[model samples]
Every structure is written in structure tokens, then in C-alpha cells.
Target: MRSEPVPAPAGDRRSRATAELTWPGKRVGHHAGLVPVPSPARASWDVRGRLVCGERADSLLLRADAGVALAELLAAPGAVDGGVKLCYLDPPYNTGERFAHYDDRSDRAAWLSTLRDHLLLARELLAADGSLWLHLDDSEQHRARCVLDEVFGEEAFVATIIWQKRTSRDNRKAFSSMHDYIHVYAPAGPKVWKSVRNGLPDEGAFSNPDGDPRGPWRSVPMNVQAGHATAGQFYTVTTPTGVRHDPPPGRCWTYTAPRLAELVADGRVYWPRGGDGKPRLKRYQSEVTGLAPFTIWTADEVGDTGSAKRALLSEFPGLQAFDTPKPLGLLERIVSVATDPGDLVLDYYLGSGTTAVAAQRLGRRWIGVEQSARTVEEFTLPRLHAAWADAPGGGFAFGAF
Candidate 1:
């Protein structure tokens, strides 16, 4: 979006970014034959990508061009391995609105054009065991999904994580918009993706019964309906007190007679009025069907706009970078599910660098390369420095940076 070549300053600040810092790949810059611009580095100092080998802590604020960023990364991937594991990209929605740094606002056609640039690099830069989680709204979620299908292959598609970007309906239009989508696609083999099986609800319809020793227990009836004439399920059940019960006409027993007989002998079946009654299966909190992460993230679960604003204030008292930057808690949850400590995380649209700070706080290494130095300077840096002050052990020192 920077149409003219940025003239290098006369003094030491105009140093060239290294090959590791700048993609050696040839991209037609807005200016013909213009060299890629090198953004300043505070932590790992490089003219562009060449590492001076100062020191790396939990986080890095790498500045690079997304247009040519991948080319530079692929030109020297081995150097990039230590810092980037999971890449989160939110390209321009092409909604005809001007962004902070990239000013070439687009309509529908240009959005797709911008998307290809992001997808191509993500495929090239992402770890073979890593995953790419793309964020988009109704304007481009479907289009991006198709593009992902083409690049990562249809089978590589993970879950279409639905994030409730807003709580109340806009009511400004016919259909109120409240949610956004995050399409998750990962490497097919040796997945580096890390997710904790969320803890079970403490206060659900469960109670401690029989003191099974493995936690709380709950009841879920095992009666599966297979319609009429199901084999081996027409038999009658009787209680220990001689009360007989049959399947309610059309309904059939959950298990075949042989399996039911096995449970009958093992005393696993819970029959209230004796064996003659319909049976109920016991499901324990310990034995949940599958420990699943919450895909349906609501405003309450991830923090609403008000909370996000407060989080921004925690870092910058009276400054809000973009209209709706996500809460650090939301990102922490995403990081909790997508990556682990010592992993590399990248955010392409580093609005306020929430992902970078969250990773640092949670113990994961991060590299945030925002195109807008203004946003980084005004929004990201101050808060990140404050967070650095709160880091455990010694703290981040930009003097060495």
C-alpha cells in the first residue's frame, strides 16, 4: 500500500534488512525495481532479517512486508523456525475501508486478490506440523475458506470455529450481525497443534453417586430407538424384586441382548423397580464421550467489547487502536487451544499486538510483524513494555534490543 519507495534516513537507521529479515523472493513493489523496505527492530536487531544475535526472550516485534514477507521467509526458512509455529492471519476484508498502514482499500474483487497473497505465504511459512487459523467476517469468510481448500487441500480442513464477535444484534440492518468465523486448517501429519481438554463443568446435572472414586457421575438413558422388529431387543426386563418391564412398543434397547446380558450380570445396569424395568446407563464426568474445546465462543466466554476496551486501557489508558480489537482473554483461549510454550506464533494483522503479548504472558515465544509502525509505536509498544515490566524472573530490556 506504500506507493512510493521509502527513502532511507541519512544516519545508521537506514540499514538494509537481512535476507532472513527480508524475503529474497522477487515481488513487484509499488515502485518499479524498488528494494524492499526494512523496518526498525528493537529486540533482535537486524537491518532487515539478518540476526545480530543480541538476545531473544519470550517475545519479538518483527517488522516485515506481508506482500513480500513470505518470499523473504521461504528464502531462509531455517532461520525462521525458532520463532514462528502457529500463524494467525486476518487480511483486509476488502470492504472498501482504509486500513491503518495499507491504504489501498478494495471492493469485492480486490479482497480475493489480497487473500491469495496471504494464503500463499502461510502455506510456505507455516510449520509442517503447525496449523493456520484465519480470521474473517461474513464479508469474506466463505471466500477465504474456498481459497484455503485450494491451498491446504480440502481434506486438511479442520473445524470452522464460530466466534461470537459481538453480543447484541446490531439492529441497524435487517439481519443483525453478531458472530464471526475462524477457519482452522492444519498440517496433515505429526501435528504440532496443542489443545487442553477443557475441564468438565463443576455444576451441571451431575452428582457424586456410588462413590465410584473417579469423580462425579450422571445418568444418560441407554435406550436407542431402532423402530420396530429390531433383533434381540424385544425381550423383557425384570427387577431383582420381580418387576417386569418391556421396551415402549416402537422403542428398542440401546444394546443387543448379548451385551445387555453382560451388563445385567456385571450389575452395571441401574434398574429402579428391578430387572423388569427400563434401564438407564451411568455416565461419569471422568468418562465424558470426548473432551472437546468450546467452538461456540460467546461474548461472555471470551470477553465482550466493553472488556476488550478495558484491556486496551490496561495497556493504553485512553487509546483504542481499531474499532473492535479482540480481548487478550480471547486470544489466550485461542493460544491455549492452538499452541504451547516455546512455540512460535505470528499475527499478520497485528492491530494492537494482543496475540504477541498474550503469548509472552502465557510463556510461548512470539514474533509479531505489523506493517504499521504507527500502530506498533502508538498501540503495541507501550503496553508490551508495561507487560515486560510485569514479566516473571528478570524483565525484558530494550537497551540490549
Candidate 2:
């Protein structure tokens, strides 16, 4: 990738910085904070640096600046126009909370404006089959939905995943806000997106009770709704116990007479020894793909805030810079569902860099952008370096903008 800095906007504070910063090596220690510069032309501020990892060096691209200003950094020259497979964002929730490096408080208009600007630019970076996962709480989810509809269009809207962030109830409030929403959108359309499935807990549910050479298999109903059934699908099946069975009430055989006969001939039908049992189709374990993902995500399936905090503490023994960092499991689920190995994943709101770590662990390419120098130096960069070092392989480049 290129190491040259993106041309600074005219009259911006960073325009005076003659040399752009670039760090291109194996791995390095966290550096001092970027000195703030005044901008006489615009209210917005800027930082300077361009970190680039060589093609065979590392699988990470990290930028320290307002993610809103690094569109060019993400979409480098000669790269695919819309190559990003997944864009996961966890921007400030406009909760009026203050952090060590950045402020989260903003008026309704200002907050929406900031989000809108970033999302509009992010949409351009998405591939035709790419998806965006926006993490937020009830504070502004409704308003944000309207904004997303405007940017991605109503047709591109996907499911809103409700993740249980915490397990305990907040007795202080009448009702506890224990969950957060992950708004998913496909910029091109949902059709271009691939199907995502969750891994099954165990293969014990599939067994070869019948001792068929197929190894292991499960049984499923062999009936279809009568409303959608055709005349040829109405048939009778006889069990090994000499008991004849017909479709119950408003259902018909799932297969046509010829198909059912073919299945019976192939020994693919499961006929029970008992007279009361219905015949079922044998579904081989090898033929099964995976379970479909649901809208509600429990803390057990993913991880909770308590677990995330503990994980962060383990990653960085003494530091306590982040209040609500997402668990690696959560981002792993999002990345697994949205992108494949080697696919490009982007996280502009890099926070504690959990998304980058998760993507790296899963063997996917990643880009993380954060505006806070403190978060980058203290939490995100350190955690990422440790993860990369401890793991078998991977590398990243750090840059400022």
C-alpha cells in the first residue's frame, strides 16, 4: 500500500505540517500524543501521519484521527472501488459522557450531522455485496434508523440485531436498559449479501441409530402444508411395522409419489418400528450446513459487558481507559456473519480495537480508525500489538491523520 499522506484540505491546521508521518516496520511502541493545531478556516480539526504496512508485512491498517476525515486513506489508489466487505462502527452514543480524549456530548442536529457525514462516506467504501453494522443503544437508535434509511435507502435495510449487553437489572431505573441494537444495512441491496449461519453446539444430536453407512443423521418431518401441496404430493407411507400412515389434518407428504418411492428405494426414509410414529426423511449430518442466525443475541451466545471488561483487563493488566469495550466474541460473530477469510473489514470507531483483534484472529484483513490519541496509544494499539505477537502471525501499520 502507499505511504504518502492524503493531500490536506486547504487552510486546515495540518496544512502547515510539511512532512507526513509514516511508520513502516514490524511493530513499535506507542508514541507521544499528536499536538493539536488551530484551524483558522474551518471548525473541524486535523491530525497528520500515514501508516502503511507492506503487502507481505501485516494484515492491519490503523489510522488515528477523526474517521470522518480519512476516506481517502481507506480507499487507497488502484484499490478496488468498493472492496470493503464489512464496515462495523461503534461511534459515540451521544450520551453526554466525557472520555479522557474525546467528548460524546452533542446536540441532536450536530450528532446526526456527524453520523450522517461519516455514514455517507462509509457507504461509498462498501462493495456491492458489502454490509454495515452500526452499534448503538436506545439513546439515538430510532433517529439513527431514519438517518440510515436516508443514506442506504429503505430497500437496503437489513435486520436490527438486539444484543443483550448486560445480564443484571439496573434497579435505579424503572426498566433496565440491558440491551443494545446493531443496525445492519446493505448498501447495494440485501440480495447481494451472502447467507450467514451460526455453528451448532455439538454433533451429538446427529446419530446413526439406524446403522446406515451414511455415518450420522437426523430426522425431519415429511409433511407440507395442504395449502401449498399438489395432488401428487398426497400419498400414504407404510412403516416397517406394517402400519400405514397418511398425512395428518391439513398437511400432505413433502414429496411426490415418485420421489417418495425413490427415497424409499434408496433407504433414505426413516420408518419407525412403533405404529404410532410418523415416517420422517433422514437428514444426514454431512448434508446439513449450519443454523440460521436469529435477531436476538443473548449474552451467553455472545458476551456481556462484565465479560468484556474482564477481557480488556486481561489484555492490558493495569490500564483502565475504556468503560465499555465490546467483547471479542461479539465482533467475531459480526465478522463471521458478514465477511469471509481475507475479506476487508473496516471499523472507523476503533475504541479498544476489539474489531481489529477479532478480524485478525479470524484471518481477515482489517482497517481501524480512531480519533483519540490516548485510546490509540494506551488501549487500542497495545492490545492489538499484544494480540498479534501472541498469535501465530499478522502485522499492522499505525498512521495519524
Candidate 3:
């Protein structure tokens, strides 16, 4: 309900960094505040290593390990504050099933205890200009909202993205739930965030239909409102070729006379012989970023289970334990909106490693924290390697280098 948006109180540091990273020629950037381009191949505990950002970390996947235990991470004794633009924590929804390597179906008491610690660590790791996205369902959304408002502060609440993860409902009960929530929270105002614009529709709307050479375009209605004096409002517009037409009495042009003249000079208005005799504006596809996205994620825009499964399966044959993994498109949008090309993204739950895969696909650096060796070793890693197989740098080669 309450938000505190100050003007650049974060000082010259954030401004300098933003300018440096987004500058036209300065993009395709270097890793900043990293733990030194991870020599994690050399780090191996007796248990298997969960390789992330080309380095290994301890795993905590499995029902028994689901309880939050972050003494080591917090007891960092002497840690530094390298900023975090965004943090995505997708914890188990207490779904009563074993996912990947995690068995998180615990009793209520234990679950709340773990939840508290999870929120604690997330708050600690967050940057002042950064935000946190926690994924959950109706069962815990209200409860989680209370906890998050307390932790991240009620004022920090952004929008709750309702993602429709399915095409239809289960229909098992009177009303089945088919949607999941992607809750967004920021430490401060939205200065450090970016919104993604995807590729245009395939309708060829951007085409130079009239061969104007400027690019593709579609006819846009030039009249958006109506005038009171219908008779006086209507007037005839004649083309150089002698074609004539008049607008409706109440209708007025979208652009004023001067603006309409400019469009005519630019050859963007259509004056075909028609009943209304009104002019329409031409909107070039090249002139706009694809339509913006809404908070509700659907199967239509992103992919459904079939596409997601094939994407993972193609990379690692016979590796099929995790179900309901997100498609590249879903995570693709998340990464595009949340982080830049070189920012660090962390997804603790890391179901099928969608966030990590998306980061890689978008040329951003990322880390996935899952407790399951199956997910880290078998599921997440192989899929990523395959995705990057044909890329210029040979895509995501892990290890010392």
C-alpha cells in the first residue's frame, strides 16, 4: 500500500554501474562482484558438487534436507556486499510429492520454521535497489504475503504475477486451481529493473506493403473520438489524384491537422476510395517493441508441458524425474524483465533450472541452488550444455576456465 521512491539515494555507484552496463557500445559486459569466475571444479565435497556459474556448491535436495539450514552462509564471518539486482526463490509448495531430488512434504511446524529462514536469507542477500520474487500457490500466498510484508516491508510490495501454468483445471473438486503466483517485491523504487519486449507477431505487419522502404506496417484507425456537431465536423479530403471522402459527423481525426499533414507527406496515410472517406494511420512494426506482457503467464504465450518436456529431454535422454518444468519462453521473459545481459540471477528451488537456462539463453550470468544431485548433475547441467552446444563460445563450458 505504501512505497518509498527517492531520487537516486543509492548514490553515484548505482548510476555509474547502470550507465556502464546499458551504454550502447558497453553492453556484452564483464562480470562484476563475482566470487572470481569460479574455479569451483576444484571444489568437491564428499557429496556430489552442484555446479553453478561453472562452479560447485553443496546440495540440499530431499525431504530430510528441505528444512532451511543456512548457518554456514550467514556465518560468512567476513563477506562483502556485492549487489543483487534480482533474486527468485521458488520453494516447494508443500505439494506432498518428491520433486527432482527434494522431498519437501513436512509437517506444518517444520515447514513454517524453514520458511522463516528462507525469507531471512533472501532478505540478507538482497540489494537495496534489487527485488525478490517468491513463487507459491493459494494455499500459502496469503500466508506468505503476510510473512513477506513483514520481512520485505509492506511498502515494498510490487505486483503479484498470476501465471496460468496449465491449459485446463483438474476439475477434481468443486473448483480446481490451475494458476500459480509469482510475487514481486523490491527493496526500493523500480529504478534498477528492466521490462522485456519480445519479438513481433509473425503476421508480417511490419512489411512495406506499399513498398515505402521504411519497413513493415499495419493500418491504424485515425479516428478515436467523436465530436458534438456531427454536421460541421464532417469534411472532404481530396487526394492529388482527385479521390474525395468525408469523416463521420461525430468522429475526429486521431492526429491533428498538422500531424495528419506530416503523415501524408511521409506517405503513411491511406486514402483509398471508401464509404467513410476517412484517413487511417500506418503503424510500422519496426517502430515498436513487440506488445508488452501482462502478469498472468499463459500456455498460449509461453509453452505448455509438452514443449517444456521436449526441451529438457532433447538435451538429456532418459532423464525424466522432474515434472511440470517451465518452458524457455516463461523463464525467458522473467530473465529479460528482471536482469540484464550480465547480471547474476539465483533460483534456490531451481525446479528444472528454468531461471538458469533462461539466463544463459539471454546471455546473462546465473546460479541455480537446488539440493538434488539428480537436478544439478543429471537434469539441469546437461540441458544447459546442450542449449549452448552450437553457440559461438561453445555455450556454457563449465570447470576451471
Please tell me which predicted candidate would have the highest TM-score against the true structure. Answer: 2
Q: Cα miss at 98, model 2 (Å)? A: 2.6
Query: Residue 46: error of model 2 in Å?
Result: 16
Candidate 1 lDDT, 1-401, residue by residue in tens? 11233232222211221221112242432223333333233225432333222244434565455655544445542536643557787666655566544553665555665565566665666655566788888777877777666566655566777877767767778998777788887654212232221222334477775665656777667666766546787777666677766777567778877887787676566665434556777666666643356668788778766678776766666654454567887788777666656677877677677887777777666666666676667886666676655654222322111
lDDT (0 to 1) per candidate: 0.60, 0.71, 0.57
lDDT of 2 by residue, 325-353 (tens): 99889999898888777777888889889
Indicate which candidate wins on lDDT: 2
TM-score of each: 0.70, 0.80, 0.65
Q: Cα deviation in Å at residue 137, candidate 2?
A: 0.6
Question: Which residue pairs show collisions in model 2?
Answer: 47-401
In model 3, the runs with Cα more than 4 Å from the true position are 1-82, 98-100, 107-113, 123-131, 153-156, 188-204, 223-279, 310-320, 388-401
**Candidate 3 C-alpha lDDT tens digits along 341-385:** 655565667767777777767766554556666566777666566
Q: Candidate order by TM-score, highest to lowest?
A: 2, 1, 3
Assess candidate 1 and give its lDDT.
Answer: 0.60
